[model samples]
Target: MASKANKELESWIKHLSGEDMPVFSGTVADVTESVNSEDSSASEVAQTILRDASLTSRLLKVANSFNYNPGGKKISTVSRAVMVLGFEQVGALTLTLALVDSLSEGVQRHKLTEEMAQSFHAAIQAQQLAKKMGCKSPEDIFVATLLSRLGNMAFWAFSGQKGTEVLNLIQSENLTEQEAELQVLGFRLRDLTVGLSKSWSLGELLDDFLSDHHGNDERHNIISIGQELAEAAKNGWDSEQVAIIFEQAAKKLGLSVDEVEELAHQNAKHAKEITRIYGVTDASKRIPQPNIDMGLIEEDVDEAKSDSTDEPRLTITEDTSTAVTSKYPEPDSNVQLTIMQEITSAIEEKPSINIILEMVLEGLHRGVGMDRALFAILSPDRRTLTCKYAIGEDNERLCKELRINLSNTNNIFHQVIDSKKAMHVPSDPKKLTGTLSRDTLTLLGPPAYLVMPVIVRSKVIGIFMADRNASGRDIEEKDFIAFQQFCQQANMGLTFLAM
Candidate 1:
């Protein structure tokens, strides 16, 4: 019987790996490999995502949503998104979106919708529990819990006759879920989940939970509780099953029963919101809210839809819609102000120089509406300037290519370093005594760029450069002023560090 089950699982794996779910499988593999790599950087992950325009837009929208960015800091670029949301969180989001997009295509079924809804609810519940327990990586728990039932979701989503048979057996014969799956498909869906998780190299957390579902591991326990809660809540929060699960969770978490219940209820609502954000509107509607009446829930959803259409709650300014749809970013003064405030807060903490530079780059790229922004630091001997941080189009390549030799004072960058004055090339190219170096023009493309020197202790130490070369947008006077303001903030940060 075990051998037969194994054979059946292998067949299902082969079938799923074929053309039916190529995008989902490929995305899981690629994202997992990118994040798991030892040498992985945010740029690499950003590059992987920037390849798909649709994915990039969807990801940015979700990242900026109130649920993720409660502080209202606008995330304008994929690189910034990766920085704001940790690498693991971004990977989880990408995988979740891919899964939803894949399953949501073609025919829709009630069973598939329920399974997806449960997955979303379970993930959010597990993530909230992990946070309450002070787990270091709540995103891992969320992803693991979401994928715990991958086999069931995938099978029901794509299966035709076999899926109906399994459901009929469970309903008619009053058989257990596992018994029905085994009788109809010759293997349990749990076994299929294990196989898929292994084949895709999902993660160690998933592998650990699947291999030992009843282990002493705290994370595994949280995931188990989340799944149980999601299933029991279907009978409504006032049901005896929900009460039992709450008692169990209260004991496990060392929280009062009321606190556990409150946490679960809040997480359920968040699950619905996040599910809709992932573009699974139908599944989101099915996630049961604890105390809210169905009519009220529907009314709330309609209001949310209306609000999203009239004025997106995610962005800070009215021009955010332009920023989203246009090739060039529109200047958002509100985002700039928020980011500047964050920079001031970061400065007070006295963090590393890299932290300050990253925030500054984000400001220039997102807040100032530059197509590309870069910070280059002078070598100890002051002979060369190397790109230290960058954000925007082709940023990884820009980092590699942006190098300036200061020995040649005839170049535009060196002139800024020498004079300690900001230069806007498009405003008046002839005002500068020196010309742009062949390397600079070749790498940065054309004129219409801003360059500012970073002066500390009355000496130039680095430079902040920005341009709209990618989108070929004109750098207006206002943009130049914003760029200078951000550069001054960088100068202030560096001076504080020097002190």
Candidate 2:
């Protein structure tokens, strides 16, 4: 029976391979172009936004959220919304809007449980910790807490009916959701999110925040605080263990125990606010979407039609609407030699990844107007992809929440991991239609994306991603060559870091 189940799983995976992969939108590309343009004025930014009605509306809605104003007077214009939020918040809101818009509308179910309420409570607890630690923006704490366990949402989105089975295994069998997902699906949602975030150009700050599982730094420590609180509050971890993690974290972050307690109280207060916004109920049986029921599944297969320009027939799969299975250009010896010379010379110098990633990402932003670029290192176990460095602007908190479990099926990161190769998708809206499922698309944000695996010897060591503007432009040969060179240098740098 076990062997039969394995065969069926393999067959399903193979069938999925033949189907088209999902594609992300060029939202991040837009953010990139707007920020990097010659003028880069508020007017240019507003003009750029005028083109996308979705971003306009999302900006307004988030502006209306309690963070913006204590009172609610609906301001009706994008410019007005921008005025209210300032440029930084406006940019963040735009990314957030694009992300929410791209989520899948597929049939899946999420059961809101007492534990769900408890999770919110934990998020608030984390916020309190941030405040106690003197984080100026407690709201950053709120956002961090809100999204730390978003992998839970990803699981519910992908698992369909067996979400419960997967959740049960996590709880009863003492497994992380990513581990269980590997047993069931070959990849976990975390894997999908990291690749998707890079592809969509969600920005480096968010990329780093989302994938920073290590809670060592000040920024990452907040997310670690939140995760610990959430696990304690929802999972019923022993109070002593929770206190230990908290005390140790607080000491590292330079906060007192009294301060941590006050933060926990704030968490309790904010839990109500989260509940009100999402309309989650303690006893709710289903997450907002329906469970996957193939019995009720509708196939919307378009007749195999050739592209107008005679490229490959890009099938729009339930996962994505874009065709992005192209190979990356090989490294250019000229560029590689220069970059490698710089890297080798700098090894003893110990350059920051920020400086290095910026040189690479900034070049892409200049060459093709990519918004941002990021890189991740696969864990020694190869089960997790943790963001190591990023370039571009956004909140550091979001990066802290980012992590990719290698088992997630919904993301292109896993594809890069498995194939140990490069993945690129063009930004033509026509081509992007079914290349990415809505949710993965939304989470990642920018549509036009490329993922390149960094291999040393035969072993896969890391992955690099670059994203273009909302235009979702295809990576030209020159750009691909530069990317390969960048990867080669980056791999060497990381190797040095390890040594």
Task: Encode model 1's per-residue lDDT on 1-499: one tens digit a residue.
Answer: 8888788889899888886677788888878887888976665676556545456668878888998889887776665677678788899888887777677643326667678889999999999999999998899899999999999888877777887798788889999989998898898898989999998788999999999856678999899999999999877778899999999999988899999999999999999988888777767887998876656646644655455335422221122443265655568897688778777876786866766777777778767888878889899999899987677777777788888777877877887888889988763566656777778678878788899998887888899899888887888899999999988998998899889
Tens digits of per-residue lDDT for model 2 on 149-249? Answer: 44444334334556667767887999976788776656555654454455545455446777765445565667666666655543223357666766876
Each candidate: how many clashes? 0, 67
Candidate 1 local distance difference test against the native: 0.80
- lDDT at 394, model 1: 73
Candidate lDDT values, in order: 0.80, 0.50
lDDT of model 1, residue 368: 86
Q: What is candidate 2's CA lDDT for residue 195?
A: 48
What are the runs in model 1 whose C-alpha is more than 4 Å off?
Answer: 1-112, 150-201, 238-282, 291-323, 348-350, 426-443, 446-448
Query: C-alpha displacement of 74 in model 2, angstroms?
Result: 5.9
